[model samples]
Target: MAKNLDVIEQTTNELTLAERQQKKPKRKKKKLKAVWMYTLLSIFLVVSIFPFYWMFIGATNDSSKMFTNPPTLLPGDQFMTNLTNLNESIGIFRVLFNSLFVSGLYVVIALAVCASAAYVLAKYNFKGKKFIFTAFLLSMMIPYQATLIPLFQMMSDFNLLNTYFAVIAPQLCFPFAIFLLRQNFLAFPTELMESARLDGASETRIFISIVIPSMRPALAAASIFLFMTQWNNFMWPLVVLNTNDMYTFPVALSSLMGLSYIDYGQVMMGVTLATVPIIAFFLTLQKQFISGMLGSALK
Candidate 1:
């Protein structure tokens, strides 16, 4: 019996060694694949970040450094100087204020309007419901340029041209926002609304208290889009905003461009400043925005 056990143990050890030898090449292949994947991702990361790095470098350097043969890759000491020049060129503070105020207000108002419209469209059963939603989607297909002239004319007739209202009001009923939020709203449990109704809760109360709290992700996502659209809007504001004091970031930054002698430093500085709020806003709501987008997609 002892001799038999010894033979069995020797056979088991032999089989284990053979198995390890067989897996060795597979393990090496996996490691090589992982290395290549990480290398490619690193290269992509650098490529994606290079433009933003260049923007910063340009912001901190003189205008001439931007066009130098070697091209400056390092940040210089001219950030403050460029910032000062940008302020003088475009009234940076007023531009920042206008952008922040208009974008913020537009996000708030547009969110309320869109969320309500989405909620009704998603949960209610009524005549023309499908037709209305289809119309909204079709409206998105219309060229935005086509509406610009009509919108400008209406604003002009109403004495709203050159006002923040002109900028904020026209796109308040954003179709994409409505569609995104409606998809999310559709995923919400109707049973919960019914339960609230049974408890004598009003529609507005249910929306404000229960529904809104649960829809934070969707709201955050929609708010980001709304804020970005208003913040980066250029053509409409340029058409309407007659005064420099009323110009948003895009319009303000465009003011730095000259036909023959553009100050790259100040332009880069303004662009950098213009990008900051979007970054900050997105970062603030990133988790919610991601979840909302995923939720909408799943729905």
Candidate 2:
């Protein structure tokens, strides 16, 4: 009886120790997973923020110090000087105005044309509608580069080269905007349209008052995209515009690079200035941007 009791006590003790050991491994695994999560988040945060840091640092350093073997990683005191130089070199306000004008015009026209087309495709039934939509989709698949030559030729023939209209007109026909607006319109409540029509509302009146108000999120999203694309456009403008007075921000910035010397500080300042409006625009419409994305996703 004594031997049996001793064996039972030993087995109970061993089982308890085994349970404790298993608990320790599970705790260790949880800690390791937490550490890994933190490490990955830290890396992502650094990667996202580093470019802006370098840009600010470069903006505050002179050209010589900027390209040194060990690049400057901190801010210097040359910011004002760089700003003045950039303004003097390229009439900063004029370039900004040109960019804004072209981009704004493109956004307005694009929204009108695309949204109208999308409304028709979404709400109305006509022969060959699917075929027409398929053509638009195929057009989207074709690279922009492939269409550049033909577009340029058409512009040249129309004598629209070097004009703001040249840039604005082409962008008004964007297929992506058509597709986005169509998708949003498809998801819109048709009962609202029916109610408006029954109340003796004209099609144009209904579209202007009811449809547009309801589709604010989609319109805002499309406007942001159209504005950004027109603002950053470089190649087409470079080929078309020959006068310095008509130069947009991106084109003017390219002039900063010359055969002899390149102004790093001034370039950085210009870039920083260019990026500010876009950031501000996004911040203003961020709520709509998020809602539009979520709405599209849900649909």
Candidate 3:
């Protein structure tokens, strides 16, 4: 009888502990998950932003201190000196203008062409459509370097070397941009398009009034991508532009590097300067860019 009583008490205690465990709220677990997510995001953010911060800091220091044993994390006292030296050495304003002009024009014209091509390919039934799209997809697989020599030769034939047109023309028909816009265009409702067609709207009118307005997010996203591509482009500009005055920002920054005795501070300053416009551009369109890309995923 005493042994039975002890067994009964032990079972009751076990049951009570189980019940208490089951009654506990899950908020602590949820908080833990949130903490982990925030921690990861904070780490990633720091990793992404640190390089740019280091570049800015390096810009402020002279060459000797810039590459010290521990490496300088703090801004030094040479910001103005570097800026003045850079300005006097290279025509920074002219280089900046060249980059801005080339990038902006490329975005505008590239978007227009890519959007129109994507719209037609997505909506209109035409001969060789599959073949054409397949060709574009295949073209995307061709590395840019593979076509460099041919493109240079063609540009030389047209006597367009060193011109902004040479840079902008070749990139106008970007396969990836067309593919992206086409995907977004494919998501539009057929019923709406049919209704618009029944209303006797011209194709151009339908595209401008119906399609373009509906795809602002995609357009904004593509614009940012295209702008950044042209902005940070180094190789093509380096190869094509021989004149210092005509050189884009990336090419000009590279020019600051000497075979012997590279000026670390001046180069960093150029990089910092080159980076500002891109940062400003991204910030300006970040909302639209994110929303547009996310909307495509939702579709």
Q: Please tell me which predicted candidate would have the highest lDDT against the true structure.
A: 1
Task: Please give, for residues 1-299, the per-residue lDDT of candidate 3 as tens digits.
Answer: 99999999999999988976875556668788999999999999999999988898989999788768798789999999999888877889999999999999999999999999999999989999999999998999999999999999999999999999998888899999999999889988878888999999987899999989989988888888899999999899888887999999999888878898888888989999998998899899989888887886775
What are the lDDT scores of the predictions, listed in order?
A: 0.94, 0.89, 0.90
- At residue 258, candidate 1 shows an lDDT of 76
Give the candidate order by descending lDDT. Answer: 1, 3, 2
lDDT of 1: 0.94
Q: Report the C-alpha lDDT of model 2 over 1-299, residue by residue, as the tens digit.
A: 99999999999989989987978889899999999999999999999999988888888888788778777787999999999999999999999999988887788888899999998889889999999888987888888798789999999999999998887777687888989889889988999999989999999998889898889899999889988998899988877788888999999999998998889999999999999888888899889989988977886
lDDT score, candidate 3, position 206: 91
| Winner on lDDT (1 vs 3) | 1
Clashing residue pairs in candidate 2 are none
| Per-residue alpha-carbon lDDT of candidate 1 for residues 1-299, written as tens digits (9 for 90 to 100) | 99999999999989988987998899899999999999999999999999999999999999999988887889999999999999999999999999999999999999999999999999999999999999999999999799999989999999998999999898999999999999889989999999999999999999999999999998998899999999999999999899989899899899878799999999999999999999999999999989877876775
TM-scores for every candidate against the unseen true structure = 0.91, 0.86, 0.89
Off by over 4 Å in 2: 1-35, 297-299
Enumerate clash totals for all models, in the order shown: 0, 0, 0
Model 3: which ten-residue window has the lowest total lDDT?
A: 19-28
RMSD in Å for model 2: 7.6
